[model samples]
Target: MTRDQVLEFVKAHPASFMATVDGGEPRVRAMHTALIEPVGLTFCTGVNKDVHRQLVANPSVELAYWDPKTGVQVRVRGEMEHLDDLDLKKRIVNDVFTFLQPVVEQFGYDVLSLFRLAKGTSIVWRAAQGAAPMEVAEF
Candidate 1:
């Protein structure tokens, strides 16, 4: 699939499994994709989350998604980094909370402590050797 196609698929299927290294073993957790920019896939998580801690230990991660109906699966591997931009954080908060205002308001902004993070140079795969790794971005 082309880059646009892959991105569209990712947008359509927003939830994905984010894998990180923990004690030399792969730990996977479900997460929502906040946004997809030209750089790579952007996501957010609580700073106290296990996945966030694992990412600090090892920036390398893998994201996997599948559609049973379409029989299509995508695996993305890349390096992740915490985005320190306040504007970006604000944007994410505004966008994410728009759909979850009531729930988030009840939970408080403490839930937003974990920031805008991104998986850079995301490589997309269709299947086992079905496609080569495509560079999404650097740094």
Candidate 2:
């Protein structure tokens, strides 16, 4: 897939697993992306969360998306860029995800952290248990 296709694919599959390293160990968990834009992919987490702290200590991460319908998997490796834009954070809580309203109200937004994936190489794997990637795209 081309870069645009990769972005579109990510948008199609918003629920993904993100793996982050903490003190030489890997930690991965399910995460839902807020959006996938030409600029980058946006995700949010609680500031006090371990994923947040792990990322603060080490910005490197890998995100994986699996499409069961087509048996395709995509992995993106990159650095996370922290966004300090209050407007963006507000929109994420107030607009994109109204479900997070209560949490935002409880924590007053300060507990939220926004991150954008940047400068990544995405590899697509298809239909095999241990096969090599079919294509690689840089974003």
Candidate 3:
């Protein structure tokens, strides 16, 4: 698939499993992306959250998005870039993720952390029952 195709797929399937390192161990959690941009994936979390702390300690991360209905999977691996755009935080919380407004109001905007995987190597695969990991897309 082309880069545009990859972005479209990611926009359709924004829910992903994000992997981060804690101490010397690995941790994974479900995350829904706030937006899919030309640059990369965008996500947000609480500053106090383990995921945020882990990313700060070790920026390496892997984000995997899988669509059960489509039987497609996209995995992106790269360093997490901590973003300091307050406008983005407000826009995301107030627009895209309004459900998080209460949390943002309670903990304040500073509690909300923003991250971006602007440039990363992504590998896409289609479910084929027992097929090996095939490279299906490149950005």
Candidate 4:
């Protein structure tokens, strides 16, 4: 698949599983993508969560996505950073809430922690109908 195809697939899918390393073990959790802009993937989590602590200890992480109908899966591995900009945080909140409005009520924005995964890692996409799995290293 092409880079645009991979990005489009990620954009269509909002949720992904994030994996983090703690000591010698690996921990995985379900998370929502706050934004999938051209720069990179953005997400948010509570600062008190274990994943947050794990990221603080080691910024390396992996995110995975799967589509049952299409028999396609994508894995993204990269370095992560905790974003401190208030404006960026607001944009993420607005974007996420806009998509989630159907299931919840609109309340004032809260201080949700935001993080950006650096694009210099790699993305692997696999599909049953494709010639071979595609590996994209975002340098």
Candidate 5:
């Protein structure tokens, strides 16, 4: 798959499983992909969440998007770039994460943290391929 194909696959399946490191131990969590563009895959989390603290301590991460019905998976590995733009945060709260509006009202936008996997290596796999090598792309 090409880079654009990988992005589109991720956009179609935005429910991602993210892996981060905490004190040399691996931690995984379900994360919603807030936005996807030419720039990167964007995500949002609460500032007080362990995921946020782990990302801050160790930016390296791997995100996996899987489709069980078709048995297709896309894995992206890279460093996480923290986004501090208030406008972007506001947009995220208002648009992608509407449930966060109540939280934002109580604690403001600073309570939310944004991250982007701007540069990464992506691997796409399909169950139909069996043991064959996966398709790889970088962006």
Candidate 6:
């Protein structure tokens, strides 16, 4: 798949799982895609959360998105960039993650940390392909 196609597929399947390294062990969690642009895929987490701490210590991450009906899976692997832009944080809180409003109220916007997968390699796999080689794209 092309890079644009891979990005579009991810945008369509925004509900995804993200994996990060905690110490030497691997940790995975369900995460919502905060935003998607030509630049990269963005995500938000609480600054006090373990995920944030892990990302800060080790920026490398991998995200997976799947479409059950289509049996399609896309995986993105790269290092994350911690974003400190207040405007982007406001946009994420006000638009994408309204549920964070209460957290924002309690700890302010800084409580919500933003990270972007600025550069990554994406692989697309289809169930129909079975064990065949997956299509890979770089962003």
* Per-model tally of clashing residue pairs: 0, 0, 0, 0, 0, 0
Off by over 4 Å in 5: none
After superposition, which runs of candidate 2 have C-alpha atoms over 4 Å from their true positions? Answer: 128-133
Q: Clashing residue pairs, candidate 3? A: none
Model 5 lDDT tens row, 14-125: 9999999999999999999999988999999989999999999999999999989999999999999999899999888888899989889988888999999999899889
Q: Which should have the higher lDDT, number 3 or number 5?
A: 5
Judged by lDDT against the true structure, how good is candidate 5? 0.92
Return the candidate ranking by lDDT, descending: 5, 6, 2, 3, 4, 1
Off by over 4 Å in 6: none
Best by TM-score: 5
RMSD of 2: 1.6
Candidate 2 lDDT, 32-126, residue by residue in tens:
99978888889998998999998888999899999999899989989999889889989888878888899888878888998999678998998
- Cα error of candidate 4 at position 54, Å: 1.0
Candidate number with the higher TM-score (1 or 4): 4
| Tens-digit lDDT string for candidate 3 (1-139) | 6677777988998889999999799899999999888987889998989998998899899888888997888888889899999999999998899998888878889988999988767888888744886674445
- Between prediction 1 and prediction 2, the one with superior TM-score is 2
Q: Global lDDT of each model?
A: 0.67, 0.89, 0.86, 0.74, 0.92, 0.91
Candidate 1, residue 93: how far the Cα is off, in Å:
1.7
The deviation in Å at residue 72 for candidate 4 is 1.0
Model 5: which ten-residue window has the lowest total lDDT? 1-10
lDDT of 4 at 56: 82
Sort the candidates on TM-score, descending order: 5, 6, 2, 3, 4, 1
TM-score of 2: 0.93
Indicate the residue-level lDDT of 52 in model 2.
91
Q: What does the lDDT come to for candidate 2?
A: 0.89
